[model samples]
Target: MINIQSGIPGFDQLTVSELTEGGIPEKSTTLIYGPPKTGKSIFCNQFTYNGLSNQEPCLYVSTDQGYKQVQRDMTDFQWLIQNYIQNQTIYFIDGISHLSGGKFENKNNIVSSSVSNPADLMVKVGIGTRNVYKTSNHFRSILDSLNTLFAFNPDQMVIKILKAYLRRITEAGGTGLIAYTEGITDPKTENELKSLFNNTIRLDGQHIHIKSDHPDFDEVQYFESTYTITDNGIVVNENNFKNIN
Candidate 1:
């Protein structure tokens, strides 16, 4: 299995390359769940930026905010998505535009399409994913916040569609990250949603806990570390998180 570097030095060190190469395993989907303001979005930004820097095509499906805001945030961190946008290496599914009655417009060379409804999200993402694959079969993607869809649709429906969509991405040889709001669902519901991914990252303030499975390991492996989000992205004090179980 191939692994793509996560771009954050601390994440690479904390997870260790032996297990998953200190990065996200290629063609696998990872779930990122945490409370609000816990750096989940920043984590997604860093991952997306890493893919762009590596010339990997990326698809960002935004349900909680506009693609413009995401670009603005990446700019504030100096990640720079403009070049990628120009080159068409990055695509976005703006799930907010239709909700606002089409007030949003595609600016510059930004490649984006709006979803008409929650169910249409799958179609929008498929379009973005196919477009990215045109540049490279190996790509990266992120769906920002599943909670918004859950608000309008049934939890089971969201999970079922998300499972199918994530499976399609992986089958097409793409790695994906999904951001989900914690505490919005019961334990059973949360676990059920998390079950759809190959790996899970749970964030608590500056602390992060990761759960992953390796073919060589009989059981799942768990790791945790504290980190700070900086202008350069996530910063982990490599010394603080050596205990891996």
Candidate 2:
């Protein structure tokens, strides 16, 4: 009853009753790992939308997509992307400039940053997170993808940046989600990330798996679901996926 509802379609349903009763734990970091086109980004968007609906301060760091594209995609799903953008409750830290290589534009609740540089990313996240912390009592954030970060920096450097970012979120006692593309990063490298993040969700094609390694986790902490990623969002059709439990 006290857990943070994912607000993701069928995610809670796929998990058993305990998860729905408890929801996603606060101050927890979740990794949404999957192959290319596995719906990780849409899940992040839905999670942010859910936070906005709950009036929770939200931060969206676009590491892979441009601001305009993100807005357009969210609009297609009928989310009022601009309303939240204008309200200042949900902020977007633009990482597109790092990819597009243009002038940075910082506006109301919109932070433009050079995420290509590891040091700049750390500083930008620090500043943006601090600003959100100062104003909002509780907030949720999504770092769109670790793939871009890993692509730009060496494995060791990316790990350091990730560690710092996670620490900031934990210190703020906020919930966070960081997604990564599976397969591209070697198992040994990803294990380093898995060791740091408590909750792991893997999407291999249509199959879905979720495991929680939180301190309070019990044997029943694992679950699965079958879902389809569509233009709207992820659609969960059944409670049990593959009966892997």
Instruction: Pick the TM-score winner.
Output: 1
* lDDT, each prediction: 0.80, 0.78
**Which tens-of-lDDT digit does each residue in 1-245 have in candidate 2?**
24677877777666655434534667788999988988888888888888888888887788888777788888888776687788788778888665676766688678777557767767778877877787674788899888888887788888888899999887986788998898757789888988888788888778788887677655537777778877678876674554344
Work out how many backbone clashes candidate 1 has: 2
- For candidate 2, give the lDDT of residue 183: 71
Candidate 2 accuracy as TM-score: 0.91
Model 1 spans > 4 angstroms off: 106-116, 214-217
Model 1 alpha-carbon miss at residue 39, Å: 0.2
Q: Candidate 1: minimum summed lDDT over ten consecutive residues — where?
A: 107-116
Task: Look at candidate 2 and tell me the lDDT of residue 18.
Answer: 45
